[model samples]
Target: MTSTKDEISLAGRREWLGLAILALPALLASLELTVTHLALPSIAADLRPSGSELLWIVDIYAFLLAGSLVTMGALGDRIGRRRLLLGGAALYGVASVLAAYSVSPAMLIGTRALMGLAGSTLMPSVVALVASMFKDTRQRGVAIGIVVASVSGGTAIGPLVGGWLLDNFWWGSVFLAGVPVMAALLVAGPRLLPEYRAPGSKRLDPVSALLSMAAILPVVYGLKQIAADGFAWRWTGAIAVGLVLGAVFLRRQRRLADPMVDLALFASRVFSASAIALALAIFVLWGVNYAIAQFLQLAHGLDPLTAGLWTAPSAAGTIAGSLLAPRLAHRFPPGGVIAAGLVLAVAGFAVLTQVGPLGLLVTGSIVISAGLAPTMALATNLMIGAAPAERAGGAAAISATAPQLGGALGIALLGSLITAVYRDQFGHDAELTREALGSAAGADAFTTGFQVSAGVSAVLLLVTAAGAARFLPR
Candidate 1:
């Protein structure tokens, strides 16, 4: 491991305080991810976007964020982590204002893309800083847990905050929420976060960066289009082109003396398994979360605030799981704890399949979120730990990318399934308006959609649990 005098000392009080400051940006990044879900209807009403445009509004952020993560992480190593982070935060604040004031669908989408680009910088920087700050393994575990908790917690709380704002103000308020938080981070971050860069890191490859975006953007866009409109030549062509470009990207990385992505990292069984598991876990969590949020507001006919309040349990459960994970790992093997967490998610998904009342839905969400949180946290810890200390930024970027990809796939796959089921079950009914389908026959359609999605999610979680048991280090 490459070392410097800056990283030689064991962390003390200042380091911990710095962790708290770093969390603001991390929380800001994650909060933006989920906070827009409840506000979609409001935006649609005001902006009058088409169906495809509506989907793009949400998916674009994840698409760009996933595409840029590795490159930004590598950029952090070459430049400086804190420097990129602070710059990104400044840009994020401006993007938020543009998003909030957007008058057209195209403008909103463009601003969200900017937000995603800015977010890409923040995600890896803070995590890498944490890895640098707390050198002790046990302390790093807790510190990482806190950071993970901040992310999951932001997702859980996003709906409530967004809902409250929507109830009191306009949908634009959701995007505006980030302005002050980013400002706070800007103020506090420079004082707290220590800058770290990889020694002897090579100059970033512009071709690799372009190729990464080219590969990811088309694949994600194609997958989303496939879900919205059944297999078409354009969608298939996009996927094929993406795959070819991805192959070329991989080949170029192998040829580089200092690649943007080190091919050798995947060779470690621990890193690969943990990364895959993290992705799968997030895939299920985000998919289910998307379905539930719609179910609460559209089907159950709850106002935004009530829906937010009901959903709060899931975030609470995630926080509980994060705090409990390290202690559980001390008693049980890490793999076992992760497997147990998946099993809990399985139970939660099963509960949703029953199509019970709000109480049952809430209970299932709590259980599922609680189960998934520790799995994500512990798996991330493993991925970060498996890497060389100097490469922590890239490793953390990969870990962050898994969830972004999963969440995008989730919104595309599960959201499409819901639309398909809703149209099949109630689309022909003249009584239901397109937007008012929720008020008309929403319950039957949304519940059917939720049941279908939940059943699939449960099976995936079970299989993933077995994989966790078999592949992860015991």
Candidate 2:
């Protein structure tokens, strides 16, 4: 039943070039995510933001981005993907410039929020466009791998790039760093990226858009709160309200003639399994990376730039794994490949439990990165591939949203666990060392927490590997 066109790759030199152009937004978005971590201290020093305002400055962008993705994805399907992408790129460029010049905490927060909304358009469009361009399965897998690598590469280099900028220039320069990238994307995007709009797609439903945002924003905000301040009734209540709203959103979708999100896509085991696997992979990766970054800076007493350099190997490992995944899939079944990678991740997490030496920590991280990269790439490929072409934008949005939610949950739950362990282990001196991890007791307690969290992560990955093998299609 398969057509010859499905088997043959239609992508030519131009398509390859277009793929590169599409990757820029994904790379920039991820870079923006981590770049601000280093810039926060500089921002605090210059802007003198209140504690609440600083949190908003840091959190608002991600909150808005996550909440907006599903609506934007559906919007791309109704409008043209390339059109949405180019428009978003222009907005992102303007917002970046505004962010750089902001004189007050409130101004910076508003600009960051705009950047987040602009960013929501990029990932789904990029993925859906790539899917449309690469008709052949193998080529599509390879192309998505490259895109995934770009994301990982951006996250890895963000702090290093931000550190170098901070060393030479003011804090605002970090925000400006994205301007040129967006400018280039704006200039090159229309020429290279092909337009894709689903035929007969209805007008976007404003009510559905509002419901999606209302459901997602509260949940994301709650998770971020849990990460920062541990569990409280206010945070848990927000999560519960979001869940109720989410159920209402789903019920509304089932009744709509043309749903914003196609409820049928989740019926496919391949789609659902791939999505869950992808989320789990990111959950562990982001959670552990959070702890590791602090470990390098607070425990080992390294500068941001130096610590970033040390983390480069892990990025290289991820790049290598992503590039190699499609080739491996050609030889073995995709599910098996994913399972094998997760097993390798288990070994990597095992190594982390014994991270007494700096080398061991770095090695474990690299191994973990290498192990998870394939899951990210191939699971994404499987998830997108499972969707009908008409629904590719929504599918890509779901793909984008899962990792964001997972990363948030991982940071909240795992970060909270680590803090709880540290406090418990610190015993009577916990209050004394609360502000900084300067004391020997504080350092030792953190290390213990790190080890315990790694051990827990290892078990979770092991179970996930089994699920991937059993549930994911061969």
Candidate 3:
């Protein structure tokens, strides 16, 4: 007969396998998915897809992912995370090939949307699997750190990987980046990863699934369009329709026995407050990164490769902060750590706005990232920790929604702010072509845009900080 300690050790090894399977795809998916943002000009020059088509190609993945995560995650509970993870991995690889060899922009964009569906299937399922696999809260906390690290820091790796491929090969090579990692995971996954099915899950609820998609797609699409096309009446109409649908969807979720997202979890003051802070942190996270990247490439004349290198400090800071989060949480409450992170992130943004030096921005970015980094792990853990084990997926579904909304809104709000500023400042400079305005509107317009975006990001950070302090438990 086996000793209790031996059984425990075997169980521990089995639990770790889930995180291993998760980390590779989570990292590659995030990195490859967004890495192409910088290569838009190159894509336009080669494939010549129209403006709207290009935006669709850029946004359709996020649109689909954000819309479908809750539904897919619920499905995973009914089926099994391990089985679906392997299936989703296969789908991701197939879609990557399609994206790499697309004959038309529409084909490429559609494939990307499918890839997003595959991603949503995989993301929450991985987290759910981790929770189920690791019976130990401490181990799961560390596992959560790994997940947050992949989500937060993956984009940092994105530029370097995408930049290198753009520098040497072709634009499509960015999609190819995920291929090798997927292949390795597929080979190792079956042997290493244990299969997981919820012990007492019911059949997936169709009504809840349909309402979720209906509610999220319109809002995300409208926000994205607003970012690219400005504040048009059509976009406003879509937003209004979406919000109404969302209200209806929420009512339905509250009444459901098995909701895709648990609406009731917001009752926890700590959970609600942390979610607020987490959402706002994401707003600054993407906004400043987007603004700063364009600024460095356009104003400083760095190649995509070198420009990516300059971002290393910020990435490192984010990863470091994520790693330190659990330890900090042990010493202080989740609220304190989150508020502290927001302060650092705000101070970092302040430094970036006033300072023009590249080295300084990098240093500030790193410092700021360190602060905001731990918030994700702590927030995610807190949300999941309080959830009924059966509703872990639902809690995650709710948690994930805020950040995706924040990201889309962040991009749109910041994009609108910068575009409005850029237009007001340079719209009358009759000689500057749209392309030239984007490319060579000189250092001042670019700096002004960067400063404005940074300032707004700072304000959001402060708001998140205050929200955390006022409401969250000490």
Model 3 lDDT tens row, 54-150: 6567667766776787787777777887787888888988998888888788888889888888877766766776676665566667888887787
**Which pairs of residues collide in model 3?**
none
**Alpha-carbon shift of residue 420 in model 3 (angstroms):** 3.1
Q: Highest TM-score among the candidates is held by which one?
A: 1
Best-first order by lDDT: 1, 2, 3
**Order the candidates by TM-score, highest first — what do you get?**
1, 2, 3
**Per-residue CA lDDT of candidate 1, range 1-474, in tens?**
646654565688889999998878767765776668777777877898876777789888878887888789889889998998899989989999999999999999999999888888887788778878887777787887898788777876788898899999998999998899889888988898899897789899999999989998888778766655556999999999999999999999999988888878888888988888888998888788777777887888777778778877788888889888988887888988999999999999999999658889999999998999888778888888899877677787787777767776777787777766665676444233245423424677768877988998899989999999988879
lDDT value, residue 404 of candidate 3: 57
CA lDDT of every candidate: 0.82, 0.82, 0.73
**TM-scores of all candidate predictions against the true structure:** 0.94, 0.90, 0.90
Error of 1 at 243 (Å): 1.4
Instruction: Point out the worst 10-residue segment of candidate 2 by lDDT.
Output: 432-441
Which has the higher TM-score value, candidate number 1 or candidate number 3?
A: 1
